[model samples]
Target chain A: FFQISPAPSYANPGIMQETISVNDVKDAHKNWCNALLAISKAHSEGGLAKSKPLASEIIDAAYAYQFGPVAFKPTWAYGKKTFRTTKDGALSYFIGDNPKFNDPGFGIGSPGNKDYPNLKNRSPWVKCTPENFAIQIFGNTAIGMGWVHFEAADGYKSKVDKTLSYIRDDEGNLRITVHHSSTPYSW
Target chain B: FFQISPAPSYANPGIMQETISVNDVKDAHKNWCNALLAISKAHSEGGLAKSKPLASEIIDAAYAYQFGPVAFKPTWAYGKKTFRTTKDGALSYFIGDNPKFNDPGFGIGSPGNKDYPNLKNRSPWVKCTPENFAIQIFGNTAIGMGWVHFEAADGYKSKVDKTLSYIRDDEGNLRITVHHSSTPYSW
Candidate 1:
């Protein structure tokens, strides 16, 4: 006989709605970092052959998490005019045709090829070190804020603060509804 | 006799959860502008006695909308290291010791006294013109993005982009959860 799932308890309504655990949050962040590293390595190594898969994985995750969809426009604050609302726009910022602020000579696209359709060139993000991670969880909703130090392939490094807001789907998968990032101000 | 609210529809769970009408959103924005105008007028007219009540009204609305008792921190980004999380902090940004960027000669707090405890400065914001307002509502949560142009008492003008995220409380009152604002980048 097929096993029947336990009925949802009415005693605590919070229990019924809450599904994501601390582990889930941790895992998501870990996976994200891993993906970034992998993409960097792939771009430096085999170029498009290796990196495309990782980029595809990120796009898949974006869809699964409902980012850049109609409900969630994933506002990205790279610059005044470069506020990206779509997934493609975000991809463009990270590993697309956009020129890097620090080094305008070196663009932000794939490692070796700037014209590569799906994230060419190795815009190497060597490390993703996060500091002061503050996570707040409410009923089926959560927000994570942290300062991240990113080491680039060209020995360039910068610190940026990030705020990510989430909402759990009906099937209990936590999806990001808002993602905002900005470089720390310096006089 | 007591009237029970209708059961949530199984056909479309999203529709079932969405309770706010388009009118409610419009009214909220209108009231917000009105309150801002009132506060500016009160500050200019009578200082502490006049402006304190308007500030308290905003605070009460914040509480009613579930902003910053615990779950909501209401992170407001005015500038670098100028993130105001508390109600008092936000007020400080508007009409407190923080000097306005465009008009450095004139401060934001009480006109005659910078020591005015509760928003003493007659920092008259002559106009609050919002452009490109994009408001997205889902269920009990919403986000509004726009560009706001502020004209100071001395005809000094500055434009800042703003993002406001909101959530409806258990009592069906809309409250701001996140408010981020930054001046346009200048090369």
Candidate 2:
């Protein structure tokens, strides 16, 4: 279900043999995509009494300072290196090619990879407010979506959809796992 | 707000000099103890958020692997060493500590360092899972926690919580900044 680098000399290993398929696309996408979904589910599925802890947990994990530098993007530096981010601006990165300049959403592929990066040239940086997220969890699986109305440093603003997935470990216990995301576009 | 191992010397460079206050403890212990109520609001405020994409990005950043070795534990007679992930029959390390381990909750504290014995015995091991986490963020301060429940090497099972903290960067953004963890404990 995972890969390493494009290095020519890197050897192939079959440790994580579970491949992503229609059967597993849901599970394989667990940890990454599901966590996003779980948060939403935790809110909507439970009562205020129940959801409070869930909400607090979500807030604590997402906004905690412990995430430190590795969890952040130095947009200015990222722009210098990958031309994907801006300095004190909006988040920008597309999964496609030549997206419309005026388009509100971002792309998620080199024209086509997976999911719905329906636009181009913009970033899929979702402005996730605590209010916009929708979350759900299944046996050994979880999913979520948080909408962010953020404008990139370049001033590209849109209601971004942040998709998420989750999976359980070998013990058959599900956790926030996969996170698959694509910004919505109005082409 | 803090630095990592190998604490720096040279007086910390005194970025700013200011006076602080402290109080004595007066609580239910039948003695006088000091309670904290916002002694100094100057350091920085904690951060807050409902959901984050740090883990998602980490997963997306993870390279897919088709083939690789297990790099098994030590052994000379075994010849050609290969990688090995104890995915099979793996139980939680907290089993011995909490026999009633029925819940999917993570026990906080580092493994060793005299805090928790369950974790002390298992050095260099960290729990990994897919679950919701949260953090506190302020003007220039933050802290967080992430958890995922799973089975360990035997019949043991438990949840893993990876807690972290950090200070804001010059640009007023929080990065992974700093990471500290808890011992993998049972329910």
The prediction achieving the highest lDDT against the true structure is 1
User: Recovered native contacts in candidate 2, as a fraction?
Assistant: 0.09
Candidate 1 lDDT, A1-187, residue by residue in tens? 1223466567733333355555565555555556667767776686655665556567556433343332222223324433445554545444443453221111132234433233233456777765534554555655555555667776667565555566667666556565555544332
Q: State the lDDT at B26 in candidate 1.
A: 57
DockQ for all candidate structures vs. native: 0.13, 0.05
lDDT digits (tens) for residues A61-172 of candidate 2? 3321221111222111232322111111112221112233222212221222223334334333222232225566453335555654443334444444555444333222
In model 2, how well does chain A match by TM-score? 0.27
**What TM-score does chain A reach in every model?**
0.64, 0.27
Write down the DockQ of candidate 1: 0.13
> Distance (Å) between predicted and true CA of B91, model 2?
21
lDDT of 2: 0.29
Clashing residue pair totals per candidate (backbone < 3 A): 9, 106
